[model samples]
Target: MSAVLLDHHRLQYLHEAVRLGSVRAAAEALDINASVVSRQIALLEKELGLSLIERLSRGIRATEAGALLVERFRKWEADQADTVAKLRELQGLKRGHVDIVLGEGFVSDLMSGPLGRFWLRHPDLTMAFDLAGTNEVVNAVAEDRYHIGLVFNPSADPRIRVATASRQPLCAILPPGHALAGLNRPLRLHELVDHPLGLMHPSYGTRQILAMAEAAERIALAPKLTTSSINVLRHFVKSGLGLTLLPAFSIAADLADGSLAAIPIDNRLLSSSEACVITRRGRELPHAAGQLLRFLSGQMRAFRAGEPAAKMKPRATRR
Candidate 1:
């Protein structure tokens, strides 16, 4: 009947309540009274003439409308932060924050040089890194929750844009004295069948690509160990428990230090896997974030062409 206008304060209350899953939790986060949050959200619902939240047995859940609103509010917050950062840039003030979500496999490469170099060049800029699987990385970037995403063999998504990509094939990681480590040439997928194998969880892009290769080669691989941690997989092999599959760049330090050996896989799909830097399809990143994205694309070992020097060496049997 009457024109309705939403209040920013009320929207914030609703956002926090939905995010934290309870009014009391939201109140604790905001350092306010629970009643205040509930009252404000109720007022927001009244104004919108729609229920924004539904109380569950233990907590609360946002209605579909509320979820949509919350998503918009999050995007609005991100845009506002980006706008302020851009304005600061125009004033020659070098201060901004960038958030990135990436697969664990990229951690070694990112920390080895690219992250440090970027930090040295832009001392005032801050960055946050969250480790996730490829699917989570894609969703975070697409939803504007993160500025950049580093993924391996990411699935095609209309909401994602590949900023840069490099061919970084998945390789079988073997312990120095392991039989597979003595292979002078690329290892075939079927060759790993009899060995104790460790694999990343199916959620990871690495596992997804491996699955495709298995299907293509008409071989089913049943790994003895399945885990979500990349480090765990590395350790699984290092302990001589089993061999695992990962990109050579993922274990560059291990390879260089002779702690592990990575043999290229012969599967066509495995060889075609690429490490990619992605962003939201049409989103304009902040100045600092954009610069970091470009820096990573050019500097990260995973995004660079060719294998690491350790992987290029001739394989030798341990005495």
Candidate 2:
């Protein structure tokens, strides 16, 4: 008997259908008709001689066999990309793509210097960045959807490997004239309670660290506003609506321009928070991604050692 062969196109259709939860959704994503997606998956199921999907009223789900196949296909796609990258390396081509997912907080530091300098060094290479919360960043990296993850105080995950980490404590951010801005020393968590507070949503790593500190110190924080956008939190404080806690690197430019002030928090857990560069465990990155990772490890302010608050002295109050 001849060896069995599975069509790559059929497998891709099945993978997208299961991933997107509907043939129509997959068709939209793949820019094809829903019937094409259905037909391709049907052919895949027939060729494999197994039930691949369970069609439901709401959407579709992969069967056990389908799930296994999808997993294998994902790994195979990652490997194929890696192989192409290696081939480019062998050809001494200084060109490839790197995909990175990171917390919104790191955007400033990344774009400030590292991104520009790296692009100058490798003009042919392309890069993409997706902004996500810490959990999303970790999951995207671990699932091989992204090549690198930049996060703060990431939870320990066996599937992730930290390339480098630097001490980046959480700091209370205040508008230039806020009462807390006058404090030359670390601010106590309790000091923030009476003031209006804006906070990142709980999905943010900064919020996670703050939650632990709140629990440890037995303090309850009630923020008037909760949002997922770092910009919103920054703007909330800058507009003097309220203060928020964040890593100094997140708003380095604001701190430097004296539009905002960052005061250290006098909590151990908050102080212990770190900025980390993470990648999937046991996976060799493409050459371009690996190079970009190393560049970020050395150049990004988040991964650099030093207290950002030291340079962020509160702007002297005017009478």
Candidate 3:
């Protein structure tokens, strides 16, 4: 074989030509001109000392040797694709899709704060958001069904990697015209139970927060409305459905708009109820995900310190 015959460009042209069925089609698929593809294929055929493709009246067909070459090159191309995929997964800055399984509360409040900002930092990493419950998040991450998971006090997975993304005190979200719209100070948990409360569905992070509140109070309190959607919950609260408790950031817009008020719950119960970040243990986070995690860690310091939300690291060779 000639030194010039074994080039990647030539081999790539041949493979694409066979796969695409014609020189013009291959060039179109490869975003190159037909002449360039034809020239490269000619060079490749000359190097192999055989015609790989036959120009038929309509289009083209591969010869016997060409068919074999296609088979071999197809495997090589598949391997090349696998190599590219794995490399992209490693760099954490590759053009790959990420499926993020987080709770509805998280997608409502925290994602826009830290995670949204991280999207601007890394544009190549596209994220698909799935609003899941604590149980769902825990199960998906433990089973490697999702790339990253943001959840609450679910049992830890030995096979999962955990990080504390953000720690915000659960605050009360009251609809307009409610008696406790804006109190002078944070209301006590018992005081909160006095009114019919809106809570998330069972097994959700919000429900966990409610359970903790109930456990602290040592009583079972039924919710006025139970749901798995933050938007629906917010709408219910806004439409005078009932007062629900959520992270302060989650109700920021409603708070600002006078439709809802955030009654601070940074008490002992709130301190114990944390949205622990969880993922598959050994997997590396993408660039945006890592940056977002860093921002969450920093911003959440204020929460642990009992201060208000103010602002918005790596395990391996992450970029």
Give the candidate number with the greatest TM-score.
2
**How badly does each model clash, as a count of residue pairs?**
0, 0, 1
Runs of candidate 2 exceeding 4 Å displacement: 1-4, 42-51, 309-319
Task: Using TM-score, rank the candidates from best to worst.
Answer: 2, 1, 3
Quality of model 1 by C-alpha lDDT: 0.87
Candidate 3 lDDT tens digits, 1-319 = 5554267777778777876688999899889999998998787788888898999886688899777776566445544544665687687645665567877665545544566565566667676788788888887766555666777656555867777644566777776456665345556667776677777787776677668667876877677777777787788777765777776555555655666667665357664556677766655655445655566656533224344542200001111
For residues 1-319, write the lDDT of model 2, one tens digit per residue.
2355978888899889998899999999999999999998998777778899999999999999999998778778888999999998999988899999999999999898889999999999988889999998998888789989999899999989999999887888888787776668678889999999999888889989899989988989999999999899999998878899888899999988888888877777887889999998978998899999999999888988674543565322211
Which segments of model 3 are wrong by more than 4 Å? 1-84, 89-94, 110-117, 285-319
lDDT of each: 0.87, 0.87, 0.66
Q: What value does the lDDT take at residue 284 in candidate 1?
A: 86
lDDT of 1 by residue, 115-203 (tens): 88988999989889999998989988887889999999999999899999998878888887777666577777899999999998888
RMSD of 2: 4.3
